[model samples]
Target chain A: AQTVTQSQPEMSVQEAETVTLSCTYDTSENNYYLFWYKQPPSRQMILVIRQEAYKQQNATENRFSVNFQKAAKSFSLKISDSQLGDTAMYFCAFMKGTGANSKLTFGKGITLSVRP
Target chain B: DVKVTQSSRYLVKRTGEKVFLECVQDMDHENMFWYRQDPGLGLRLIYFSYDVKMKEKGDIPEGYSVSREKKERFSLILESASTNQTSMYLCASRRWYEQYFGPGTRLTVT
Candidate 1:
């Protein structure tokens, strides 16, 4: 079984500033994938970014990026130039690299409020 | 772009009542999933289907059942709704590793 942990329950960031949401996971699988999802007030959860365990380089999607330390089993999301639109509940998820039956295990999630 | 749609945005039901939550996807994705979201719990998977007539229990499948008679539609059912079942229900369809989600249904069981 796999478990994801996001210790922070809530965070606040100033607009145009940067913020990092920390996440860690416990998994025995060697090959897997990590993801960050954002759910805004609209209640639509969208994928922010993704990182593969085999890749050394982190994933970046515009203002969103991740610091993936595979050895430490830590994946943190960094939001640069945070905006009001970034205010949402963010979740970290893990999935095995192989097998069609593989499912995602998600962290408790952190509520981020970007204040203007 | 993939689009997933839930039958309702909000619903209220009484205890012991049978509840049905419908989900439909426009894209021809092979896999669909049902998840429940609660405060501080993020999202917990209830059930998933890889194909028509094939269903798999997820992490939290207790008190929940799913039906996938068609490729684009998946339904979640509560045999007898309880107060604890009041939460947000999310429906998603997978395209490879990426899963696209619907707006979600806020179910309140009283």
Candidate 2:
């Protein structure tokens, strides 16, 4: 079974500043994918960024990027130029790369507070 | 844009009542999943369907059941609702590994 862990329960960042949220996972499978999903006050889960285990280069999506270290089993999300809209609960997820990949295993989640 | 829609944004039901939560995806995703979210605990999968009429039990499926009569819709059911079941329920559609989630339904079991 694959499990994702987000050590930080809560974090705060000043607007326009950068913040990094840590995530680690345990999986015996070699091929997998990591993801970060944000749930704002509206409770809509939005995909932030995703990284494939096979990709050596990290994934970047404008303001959101991931520091994916496959050897260390670490996938951290970095948010640059953070804004107030970034204040939300962020979840780290893990999924195996297979046709039978059942569902995503999520971390406990971290509450990010973007202070003005 | 891919959209996953849940039937209700908020619902309140009594104990021992049968609760049904419906989810539909606009995109023709092959896989659909149901998950429950609680404070501190992230999203835990309850059930999932790969194709129409095909289902699988996820991490926590004891008190839950599911239906997939159509390709785009998936339903999560609670045989007997309990106070512990009061939480936010989410639905998702998947193509490969990455999935698109719905707005979620806040279910309150009294």
Candidate 3:
């Protein structure tokens, strides 16, 4: 079984600044996928970014980027130039690369508030 | 773009009542999933289906059942609603590794 951990329960960032949300997971599988999802006040959950365990390079999507350390099993999301729109609950998820019906194991999310 | 839609945005049901939550995806993804979101628990998978008439139990499948008669529709059923079941329900469809989510249903069981 795989388990994801997000130690921080809440975070606050000033606008135009940078913030990093930390996440870690315990998994025995060699090949897997990591993801960051954001759920705003509207309750619509959207994908922020994703990283593959086999890839050495991190994944970056515009203002969102990920620091994926495969050996350490740490995947943290960095939000550069944070805006008020970035205020939301962020979750970290893990999925194994193998298996046909693989499902996600999510961490207890961290609520991020961006102050103007 | 992938679009996943749920039947309701907010629902209030009495205890012991049978509850049905519907989900539909337009992206034609082979895998669909049902998950529950609590304040601190992020999201926990309840059930998933890879194809029509095929269902698999997730981490928290107890007290819940699912039906997938069609390729794009998946339904989550609560046999007897309880107060503990009062939480946000999310429906998602997967394309390869990325899963697209719907605007979740906030279910309140009284």
Candidate 4:
């Protein structure tokens, strides 16, 4: 079974600063997908970004990006220019690319706090 | 915009009562999932459906069952609610990497 782990339980960042949340996974599959999801206080889960294991280049979405290290089995999320709205619980998820009925295996989560 | 809607935002039930949590998607997505969220424990998948009438058990499938009678609707059934089942339940629909989630239902089983 694949397992995703977010070592940091909570992270704090100053407004306008950058913060990185670390995540690691254990998967034997070569073709898989990694995702970053944000759950705000509103309790709505939102997709932050995604990275494909086969791609060497990291994935970036606006100020949100991921440093996906396939060799180390590490996928970390970087949030730049953090704002108050960026405060949320971030989850790292893993999924297999080959299966049509793939289910995401998620990390425990990292609660990010953006302080002004 | 894609939307996944849960039938109730909050629910309270007795321990022995049968509980049903309903979810509906507007994007006509082929995949729908039910997950329970607990503090510090993250989200644990209970069940998922790839197509109507087809279901699969997830990592934590014990004590939970799912029904997907229609393409847009997915329902989670708890045979008999227990205090341990109290948690925030999130519903999602997706085709690939991006998943659209509905506002979760906070269920309290007493």
Better of 2 and 4 by DockQ: 2
Lowest summed lDDT over 10 consecutive residues: which window, candidate 4 chain B? B93-102
Best by lDDT: 3
lDDT (tens digit, per residue) of candidate 1 on A1-116: 99999999999999999999999999998889999999998779999999989999999999999999988999999999999999999999998963557778899999999999
lDDT of 2 by residue, B1-110 (tens): 99999999999999999999999998899999999999988898899999999999998998999999999999999999999999999999999776999999999999
lDDT minimum window of 10 residues, candidate 3 chain A: A96-105
Listed per model in order, the count of residue pairs whose N, CA or C atoms clash below 3 Å is: 0, 0, 0, 0
The candidate that achieves the highest DockQ relative to the unseen native structure: 2
Model 2, position B90: C-alpha lDDT score: 93
RMSDs, each prediction?
0.9, 1.0, 0.9, 1.0
lDDT of each residue in B32-88, candidate 1, tens digit only: 999999998889999999889899999899999999999999999999999999999
* Span of ten consecutive residues with least summed lDDT in model 2 chain A: A95-104
Q: Estimate, for each residue in A1-116, the C-alpha lDDT of model 2 and write its tens digit.
A: 88899999999999999999999999999888889999998768999988888889999999999999888999999999999999999999988874854578899999999999
Model 1: number of backbone collisions? 0
Q: Mind giving the per-residue lDDT tens digits that candidate 4 earns over A15-113? A: 999999999999899999999999999778999998988889999999998888898999999899999999999999999883668889999999999
> Which of candidates 3 and 4 reaches a greater lDDT?
3
- Give the CAPRI rating of model 1: medium
Docking class of predicted structure 3: medium
Alpha-carbon deviation at B41 in model 4, angstroms: 1.0
